[model samples]
Target: MTGNGRRGRRILAAAVVAAALAGVLSGCGGPDDVSTATGSTQPAATQPSATAPVAANPEGTNAPLPEGAAVAPSPTGEPAPEQCSNPTASLRPFPDGAPESPALDRIRARGRLVVGLDTGSNLFSFRDPITGSIEGFDADIAREVARDLLGDPNLAEFRILSSADRIPALQDRLVDVVVNTVTVNCERREQVDFSTVYFEAQQRILVAQGSGIHGVADLAGRRVCTVAGSTSLTHLQRAEPDAIVLTVPSWSDCLVVLQQGQVDAVSSDDSLLAGLASQDPYLQIVGDSLSPEPYGIGINKYDPDLVRLVNASLERMRQDGTWSRIYDRWLGILGPSPGPPVPHYQD
Candidate 1:
C-alpha cells in the first residue's frame, strides 16, 4: 500500500478510538454524591475534538508574508492568445532525432544539463525521502531530455526555482532549460522560448475537507492563498474581486497558510493542487479549473536549437509510451490517464 494510504488508515483508526473513549467518558457519572450535585449539574464543555490535522501550521512559515499580500494586479482584460515567431517553430528534429548543434555542444561540454525546477512541488518534481533523489513527472521528463543530449540520464543537475524565477532563469542563461510547471502564454513567450506543450492542466480550488466551500464562486470575501507570479493569482483576482488574495513565495507556503486557517482556500492548477492534497488527506481539490494551463519547458529565447531538441525528446516520449509511464507513476492517482498533449508548433 502507498504511504498515504497507510497514514490515512492510521488516522481513521485513531479517530474511531477517540470517539469510543469520548462516548465511554460521557456514560460515566462523576461522583454521584450530594457534593457533586451542589457543585454543578451541567457536564463540563467537551474540548474540541482532535482530528488528523490538529495543528494549523505543521510545515511552519519561512518568513512573514510579503507586503500587500492581499493586493493583486487588476485584470488587463481577457488574456490574449499566444503566437510563436521563432525560425525553428515549424522545424522538425534532425533526421537522426538527436541533432548536432551548438546548443548540444555546450551541454555536452558542461557534462550536465542544468534543469530549473521545483523541489517542493510534490508529484511534479520533488525529492523522494527514501532515495534522497529528486524524481517526479517533470524531473523524469527533464532527465529524459538530458539523457538524449548527453547520453546519460543521471548527467543532469536539478536547480530549484520559485514560480517567478522560471523566465528569468532562461533569460539570464542561468540554466539551459527549465522543466518547472510553467504555463505558456504570449507574454511569457516574449521573455523565454518554450517547447511544445507537454502537459495540459486546469486551474482549480483546494480546501480542507468539510470547509463548506465548493468552488471559485464561493470565495467571495474569503482569504485565498496562491503563489506570487502565478497566473492562478490573476484569475482569482478577476473571478472573485471581493476575495482577499494572499500571495506567497511558493505553493508550499500557500499550503501552510491554508492549514493555519490563514486562508480559506488555495488555488492553482489541478496537477499542482493534487500534489498538495496528497501530502495531507485532510485537504481536497474543489470546483472546475478556472482556466486551461498548457505546461511547456522554458528554454532560452536565443536557444531555438535546444528548444527543438527538447521537443524531439518529448515527441519520442509520447510515441514510445514513456510519457504515459511517467504519468502513471506520479499522476495516475488523480484519475485515469488522459494521454499526452498533442504538440503544436507555430512558425
Candidate 2:
C-alpha cells in the first residue's frame, strides 16, 4: 500500500508540470498570430470605447455623410466638433461633399485665406516666443498659399487644432488647408481630398537611451508606447503581439510614458520620431522604418472646387522654391523632401 501511494504522488506531479508548460505556449500566440485582447477592457487602440470613430461619409464616397453634417462624437472619447463658418459660395444646407467655388475664388472674395493648422507641432507649426506668431515649414507654405490666393502673405488666418480633429474641421469648411504633417491614406482619401505627396517616410521605433530594444523582435514581454488612433499601435500588434502596448493621445505623451519607464519603446513615423529625437537627446530612434507613410494637405471632398484651387497652388509652391524653402527651414534635417507626386483622386 505504501508503494502504491508513492506512485500516485509521482503521477500527480507530472500532470502539474504539463499544465504549466501549456500556459506559457498559449501566451506567445504562435509565430504570426497577434491577438492580445483578453477579458481586459482595452479594446484595440483606435477603436476606443470613448472615442468611437464615426463611419466615414459614404454618400459620395465609402460611406456617405452629408458634408458639414453634425458629427456626434462617441461619449467615451473626443468632444463634439467645433462650429466653424462655412466657406463662401457654399450652396447647400450641409456639406453634401460638393462646393461651388474654388478656394482661390473664396480667398479673393473674403479678402483672406484662413488656414487651419496646429500651433503646437514642431518644424511644421508652433508659436514663437519672440514674435508671438506661429512658425514652421508648414506655416511658411500656408503663408504662401494665402499670398497666392489673396495677394498678401499676411492675409492668413491660423487656427490651432488637435490631430484627431483636423479632418473633421476640413470637412466642416473650417479651414482652407491643413499643413501639419498630415499623413495620406486610402480611407482618408475616401472622405476628404488630399494634395500631392510632399513627404515620404516609414514608421520607426523610439527607445529610451540604453534600454537596448534593437528591433521589433526584441519587444517580446515588454511594453511598447504608441499614439492612440494611429498606425503605430496596429503595427506593434502585428509585429510583437507578446509585448504590451500603451496607447497615448500623442507622440509627446509616448515620450512621457517612456521617461516614466512605463514602456520600453515608442513607435511612430520617422518624421515625428525625428522631432522627438531632436527634443530629447536622451532618446533615440532605433531600427529601420517598418512601413512607408506619405504626408499631404487634407482638403474637403465636398469642396472639389477648393481641391482644384489648392492643388494648383501646391503645384506653384513646388515649382517656385516655396515648398523647398519651407521644407529646408522645418524638416531639412530629416532629409531632402521627396519630389511632388501628381494628385490622384479615388472616388
Where is the poorest 10-residue window by lDDT in model 1? Answer: 30-39
The Cα error of candidate 2 at residue 304, in Å, is 1.2
Runs off by more than 4 Å, candidate 2: 1-104, 336-347
Give the runs in model 1 whose Cα sits over 4 Å from its true position.
1-91
TM-score of 2: 0.66
lDDT of 1: 0.72
| Per-residue alpha-carbon lDDT of candidate 2 for residues 1-347, written as tens digits (9 for 90 to 100) | 36456345434533432232222212211111111221233222232222222222112233321111121111222333342232111111212322345554676777876776654356666666565677777777777767766678888777665566677777887776777677776666666776666666688898878887888877755556665446566656566555555444456656655665545787888878877777788988888777777777777776666665565666687788777777777887687766554444333
Q: Give the distance in Å from residue 90's predicted Cα in candidate 1 to where it truly belongs.
A: 6.8
Residues 32-54, model 1: lDDT tens digits: 11110111223212222222122
Q: Give lDDT per model, in order.
A: 0.72, 0.59
Model 1 TM-score relative to the real fold: 0.77
State in Å the error of residue 332, model 1. 1.1
- Pick by lDDT: which candidate is best? 1
